[model samples]
Target: MNFDTNLILSIMPELARAFGVTMLTWVAGVIGAALLGFLVAVARRYGSRWLGYPLRLCVEVIRGTPFLIQLFLLYYGGPFIGLSLEPIPAGLLGLTVYGAAYFSEIFRAGFEAVPPGHVEAAECVGLNRRQIIQRILIPEMTMLVLPASVNMAIILLKETAVLSIITVPELTLVISAIGSQQYAFVESLFLLALFYWGLVELAGRLGRYMEARFSKYRFVTA
Candidate 1:
């Protein structure tokens, strides 16, 4: 069978629109996950046993289960518990929660990688906890975490494709629908793969650039 270049061209506009949704979802998810993950890491590291244990359990639970199941529970099962949400919001929440679990581990590892003497030295210099975290710990952790965080971001980006299962109108859903209606699965799937490949490639390049820019700080000690 002839490859349908025309069919691919015809769906470019729809693909572009869906691509925007995917990007928006991914960007928001990454930001939310990073911030929440940092907080979780900090709380688990410094909070009392009561708080740390629960947070640890939650993190383990989230990491152990599949994201698809978690998303289903949030979107489909939530209505039973009076937590109904639209598809997009549900997708965003699921993405954030799922990504946060992994990000927290990455952040925790980064924290551990920082020398304890650095924190002690900062404290000895009369820096309070917050100031120490902001000025010293964060800068040091950023260097350690950048590569792992970037890898997690890419994983979260790919996970957005699963959002279509909940009818989130992301790239996968739109392309699959087009393929079904037009009987052009080959063309549709090819375009979908191309878009994702391009996105992942761009993300990889950006990550490498950021890593190079930050390499000088990686070896800097307190």
Candidate 2:
């Protein structure tokens, strides 16, 4: 089939809509995963055996399994247990849960990297556990963990393409649909790659900007 530039232009609007859906899915999943991961990390570090052990097991299981399988289980297997969710929600839920396992590890490492002396100093200064964590530990961990967190965000962004499998009308799904309808498979795929490359590049630039700014802020404060 010939590569048709006009055909590509014709489908741009549809692709844009699908891209919006992809971004929405990524943003929701990443935000939810980050929060959940941080909590799990904290629990693993500080909670009791009853809470920590189960959280550890959960993180392990999620990290061990394939994301596609997890997405399928959530989208397809949920109804058997009386939990009904739409395609978008199911996709977001799977992404959040799966990404959390990996994010938890990154966060756990960040938490551990906090100097023990700092905690000791805070204690001697009459700071309570909450104050120590809030003021000293969290800020240090943010500086330590921001780069890894940005990498995880990119990973989650790529994973959003897999949601097409469950018919969530994301970019991949839109591309496939246009290809089938227009019989311009090559053109469709070319555009798909271009779009993803642009998005990945944008994410990388944004990550670098954030890291630089945060690093400068840390330096100034120091």
Best by lDDT: 1
Would you list the clashing residue pairs of candidate 1? none
lDDT of 2 at 203: 91
The residue-by-residue lDDT of candidate 1 on 62-87, one tens digit each, is 99999999999999999999999999
Off by over 4 Å in 1: none
Scored against the true structure, residue 127 in model 2 reaches a CA lDDT of: 100
Q: List the residue pairs that clash in candidate 2.
A: none
As a TM-score, model 2 comes out at 0.96
Please give the CA lDDT of all the candidate structures: 0.93, 0.90
Which candidate comes out best when scored by TM-score?
Answer: 1
List the lowest-lDDT window of 10 residues for candidate 1.
Answer: 213-222
**lDDT by residue for model 2 (169-203), tens:** 99999998889987899998998898888988999
